[model samples]
Target: MTVTLSDEARQYIGAFEEETEATAVDCLVDDEFDRLVFVVKAGEMPKAIGEGGETVQHLEEEFGRDVELVEDAPTAEGFVANALSPAAVYNVTISEMGEEDETVAYAEVAHEDRGVAIGKEGRNIKAAKELAKRHFDIDDIQLT
Candidate 1:
């Protein structure tokens, strides 16, 4: 599915690319929490985040909203793993769901990191779901 962005979101992405000089693959704007999450090109997270996370801090201050960065991955499993970064995931099993025209990703996350995997008010998982669906056609991400 092609993920279309609004004019404002497009502009935000443009600004991010210009400032960070890191290729942005996709972006999601969480209006409810006033947060913006970006997926940067693989192996470029260090440049996107800058030394000591200064880049992310600058983007947050300029956008007047919280910012999050997700590193791009080549495989579906790897993508899901990256989406749940900082949350220790033991495995990501990809399977086709016969009931629907969608795929499912069962992520085995560390018991201690379960809550972190599903962020406050479910924002983290929600973002992961959206990005997975858009970029990888993964319908659901269940933390096992």
Candidate 2:
């Protein structure tokens, strides 16, 4: 599937690369969450983050919006794992759901990290779902 980004998103991507010198696979503008999620190219996450996350903080300050960085993965399970970072997900199980052509992800997160994985108001999981749909055609995420 081809993804056509909006003008603002394209501009944001340009600015992000210029600011951080890290290649971004795609940019997600989550207006409802009042944040921007940059899907960075794999093997460049540390470069995108910079030392002590100074780059990300700078972006947040300059854009006046929350910024999240998720590393791009080569597969559906890997993508789901990357999306739930800082949450210590043990594994992600992908399975076809029903006859509606839906795909569901069962993420096994550490018990202690459950809240972190879900996030406040389920923001993290929702973002994961959205990104999964955008990049991997996954329909849902279910934390188990």
Candidate 3:
């Protein structure tokens, strides 16, 4: 389905004259409730947000609505990877092994996050493994 913004939201976007390129504002209605989400080009996030998020804060307060501004990236995968914890997983490599063609993926997590990587009673790590297997088709996960 297509998403559109209300006329009131358009007024907010026009307020930022300093931002040359036009940014996109969307109003979403989910099963739970309605929310406003703004999508701006990757490099234009700072200008869209203004200093200390004052622009979005002012808009939210004035409109009496929740607004979330998200910076759009070229690829959805790149966006997901970028949004994931960079410090925790510095590098990830995948390889296929054995005659059975099993996939093995290794993730290099930060030393500080060793405990979290392993998890309390290994529950977190197990969950991560399940999610990785589901999303990336990696049969094995080796965290270093």
Largest TM-score belongs to which candidate? 2
Clashing residue pairs in candidate 2 are none
lDDT of each: 0.91, 0.91, 0.53
Please, what are the lDDT tens digits per residue for candidate 2 over residues 1-144?
Answer: 555688899999999999999998788898888999999999999989989999999999998999999999999899998999889989999999798978999999999998988889988988889899999889999999
Clashes of each: 0, 0, 0
- Model 2 off-target regions past 4 Å? none
| Structural similarity to truth (TM-score) of each candidate | 0.95, 0.96, 0.43
On a 0 to 1 TM-score scale, where does candidate 2 land against the true structure?
Answer: 0.96
What order do you get sorting by TM-score, best first? Answer: 2, 1, 3
Deviation from native of the Cα of residue 141 in model 1, angstroms: 0.4
Window of ten residues with lowest summed lDDT in model 3: 25-34
* Candidate no. 3 TM-score: 0.43
Clashing pairs in 1: none
RMSD of 2: 1.0
Clashing pairs in 3: none
Over the stretch 45-66, how does candidate 3's per-residue lDDT look in tens digits? 7776778878777766765666
